[model samples]
Target: MTIDESALGFGSGARAVWASDPEKSRGRLHAEETSRTRSEFQRDRDRIIHTTAFRRLKHKTQVFVAHEGDHFRTRLTHTIEVAQIARALARALRIDEDLAEGVALVHDFGHTPFGHTGEDALDELLKDHGGFDHNAQSLRVVTQLERRYAAFDGLNLTWESLEGLVKHNGPLTDESGNGLDGPVPQPILDYCARQDLHIATFASLEAQVAAIADDIAYNTHDIDDGLRSGLLQLEMLEEVPFLCELLREVKDRYPELEQSRMIHEIMRRQITLMVEDVIAVAQAKLAHLKPRNADDIRSAGQAFARFSPDLQDADRSIKSFLYANLYRHPDVMRVREQAAGIVRDLFDAYVRDPSLMGGHWRTGVSGFDEAQICRRVADYLAGMTDNYAVKQHRTLFDRTPDLR
Candidate 1:
């Protein structure tokens, strides 16, 4: 018997009315002839995949440090998973898959070496100098760093891609053009001054899916990793009712299944349930909002793609559980302290003598002020992989943590 496409979450094969169209794109920052063979968003995805920052993700932290274990997910693997989910959701919603996937792939480019630990250390060290934000650093990476093309410094992605990357969570500003949560990062604000990304408006549907896909990917995988590392046990998951239910279902289906296979079964089912929930919720919102075009999605002032109210609670529950059991666990906290020390030591060493940074990073730093020097050092430091940061710390400081 044939199955209905709609039942499978393939909502009417035709493109949705509000889907982002490549031909109607907002174009790139630095103008160049469009590729004959690829859509604008495809080019954006391809360029991101080829960047040095993208390659560095392989050695960057996700939850566990990169060297923790080969089986654990790294930033690169997490990005790939996010991209896969984003693409699947985009296809189901009949939106722009390339744009969604591009956004997902590039979202974590700005993250420092040791996941949030490194970012926190850097932020505290530079608290006086606008602080460190991975999102802003991501924008800086694509727009100013990378230095690939002859005419342009960055990959020069399309405005849609850039907008999605910067506003992955949502609009950075409110109706009066004031930052909502706090001051918008200086790097993002500076870039918008040159090319208005309409930070006040919600991003396109493609971006919305990418952002939520990030939530889905990390929420599920971190638990998988935590379980693998023995930081989290199957019994601990009972704290969250949703996970408890999934665990019960898994056990019922395969009463004698081994722990590893049982965990994988639960993870795959969890992803499916979450993805379907997002698609259904988004589809319902789209029906109500009746957006006429991609711009309508941005100007709607609300995120269309998201988990339902119940699932939102579930999502929060999972995060709370992870934070308590895994992220803030004594063992993890110990490593975090060591990781933060490395970042702090490196920052001090670089700030004291820019020459310690070496090469072009040291070239013009002698003429710069304290803030300028710190920002430059941050740029160099943020680009490092987990191994590289540890190595650098070992070189400069008398002692270094093994990060085991």
Candidate 2:
């Protein structure tokens, strides 16, 4: 069966451009030519939803650790928010919502446990072996790590989805500007290129939209979390010039707001302003291209610019506050240091010899292999919650449960 062009959201103008693509009619899977229950893009979305990495996000951190509170956002929740914001932007700009949402959902699948802190430790440990990057790890997870299907080792996602994952930022060009354009220098690009799939030309405008949405979500939500944790005061924000101006505007319009309600209102306003900035830039850039199909949209010149200078300064101010007052606070720093120690120790133990690991380590035949053993240890450490990591550290290293 072939794709029903009419079922897609691309309007007549876009449809005219989409119909010209040869691959549009091809089924999602090469093996099952007769099965056509889902469009290629839809299949991408479904595959991600069912993946181990996507499910593991529920245990990963957003800002605070995952187990701090049930109400706190997990990596999974953040991915959902990014997808929601991306889909909204895609709909507004007449791009592919399915592709946008698919990319957003899988963007953080490679993040290690304990958030960025764990990632830093792992990167240092693996520095001699080509280093570790969450983005590249994400590609590895889909392509090799996950062992679900016997028919294929990886998820076997579509070329478009893979491209979106690697080059979501844009095409990689050379310093000379005259050289041929290429995909970004990430490991995912190397893997895809080795397999002979077209490397992502550049991230589609929709992917850029997702990236912006991520920035908006994290910036605003980090502030919200900081304020809620009592590390930042409303009065302090009210005195910070640019943030002061924004807070004043919120107060004038949202009087009587308090707590989470007030914070959500402030975040909503900030996100709306960011979205407006994106819309303005995109409209201006796309005005000349007249792009109507997904390929054209992806290949069009850059659709958005960096944050305005004013916004960038304000963002830096917010980041500074978070770094100095929230992230570096004694309590937070203590936990992060402890997590780093746990990760390092675990890596050392497993990398030296897999036989040292206690539970479940003795089962798998592959456990004796150093690389496989290191990965298993990493997985075990990664599956830990913040408190669990602390407990395990105490249990194994400190020699007492009540030492604290």
How accurate locally, in lDDT, is each candidate? 0.92, 0.66
Put down candidate 1 lDDT per residue, 1-404, tens digits, no spaces: 12234634365567777999989999988888988999999999999999999999999999888778899999999999999999999998899899999999999999999999989998998899999999999999999988788999989999999999998799999979899889999999999999999999999999999999999999999999999999999998999999999999999989999999999999999999898888888878887789999999998878998888889999999999999999999999999898988999899989988898956778887789999999999999999999999998888888899987
After aligning candidate 2 to the native by TM-score, how far in Å is the CA of 249 from where it should be?
1.8
Name model 2 segments beyond 4 Å from true.
Answer: 1-35, 171-186, 196-200, 239-242, 292-313, 355-404
- Residue 102 CA displacement from its true place in model 2, Å: 0.9
For model 2, state the Cα shift of residue 19 in Å: 12
Highest lDDT among the candidates is held by which one? 1
Top candidate by TM-score: 1
| Clashing pairs for predicted structure model 2, backbone only | 171-202
